[model samples]
Target: MKKVLLLLMIVIAVSCKNETKKEVKKENIIEVDKNYFPTELGKVFEKHGGINTWRKVQILSFNKGEEVHTVDLQSRRTVINTPKYSLGFNGKEVWLDEEVAGTYKGNSAFYYNLYFYFYAMPFVLADNGIIYEKIDALVFEGVKYPGYKISYKANVGNSSDDNYMIYYNSETYQMEWLKYTVTFNSKETSNKFNIIRYNKWKNVNGLILPSEITWYKKDENGLPTAPEESATKFTLPLISQVKLADSFFEKPKN
Candidate 1:
């Protein structure tokens, strides 16, 4: 009886030691990931509407004229419903309702999910593998704004080199201008950026989005202004019917 009791005690002691080692290992992993969590960018997300609230949202859709754009947050699938060309992505390759060939595939793929991402501000930027930095407000057009610059690490969607600089009004905490660059071939160099102003804003299903997005030509000093050639570069007026379900964004079959 004494020997049996001693064996049980030893087993219990080993189990406890294993648990402690596991807990310490888990804590060390969390400590490593803590650096990647952008606390400042999280404040921007909370200001708009907490990231947790946005996470609960399953589907978000908007209309730009006759075109419709929808995204499934859970699966990260996007669907662009358009009169001319419709697009669907099942989280991997973007499939089209019609068979696409040549450079059209690249063009279609680039444009299919582009504007939807723009319209889905703050929320879309909260994706995984994104790195954020709080920078000094950019002084432009005789005005200044608090800024957050976001970039993607490796394995971030199709393009990893793309960087976005979002400026927000300090008092209102509303996004003002978005400056992003297309570093297509070169993964490291970003010498130029096109700045677009968020002209109008509207709240849809508790998420703040830009309704009227206008493109601007940057001056030598990198100030954003309304382009002389165009009026409204992008418009997403019909913003409603936010729902959930990954099947909605899947490639439609006959």
Candidate 2:
């Protein structure tokens, strides 16, 4: 009886040891995959709000001009509302409802999430299928800002040929400027890049987001020449971890 009791105690100890080992291994795996962004970009993400926190967000909404734009971050479903018109993407289709005849003249498809992508910034650049490369610094007013060139895998989106450059303050690791090429309806990619300066930021739900973005006129060399008078500004930025129902983003019936 004494020998049998000793063997049972030994077995229990071994079992507990194995369980502890499994738990440690699981934790290590999560830590390893927690951050896959490049060192500098990871710092930028951490400075804004950790990438893990951004991934937890379900809904983001803000006002652009008189239009109120809301997006489902996970699904990419969007709704833009104005007194004159309502436009939205119901996961699969882009729809428009005009209160006034011919009120919305913009392309519904292209304009759906255009500003959302721009406003989301560095976080959106961390999306899947993206290729990142460290690039030479950008100098503006004698201040050198390091940056990264972002490209996408073939067949990634509507315009996979599109390219983006993210320039951030070296000391603060905060995004300062963005330069991108528009290839939305082009067969061949162009080297021409348009620039947008992130002039102001506001914190929403612990994430630092653009409150104002200024478009700059490009010089003959495809660099920013001067800030344009008309800048895109945002207000009432809100984020929620709770997701909205699909019906909310669906096309509305007349």
| Candidate No. with top TM-score | 2
Model 1, range 1-254, lDDT digits (tens) per residue? 22223333543464466500111122222111233334444555666676666776655556777656666667767777655556778787887774443323446667777877777776677788876666667776678887777779886877788888888876776777788888655656485888887778776546666778778876786777556445343444332224434565666665
TM-score of 1: 0.73
Q: TM-scores across all candidates?
A: 0.73, 0.85
Each prediction's RMSD over C-alphas, in Å, is 16.7, 16.0
Model 2 alpha-carbon miss at residue 175, Å: 0.3
Task: Give the 10-residue window scoring lowest on summed lDDT in candidate 2.
Answer: 19-28
Q: What tens digits encode model 2's per-residue C-alpha lDDT throughout 103-147?
A: 899998889889999989879998889877777777787898888
Where in model 2 is the C-alpha error above 4 Å? 1-33
* Model 1: residue 201 alpha-carbon error in angstroms: 1.0
Model 2 backbone overlap count: 0
Q: After best superposition, candidate 1 residue 247: deviation in angstroms?
A: 4.3
**Model 1 off-target regions past 4 Å?**
1-40, 99-106, 184-188, 228-247
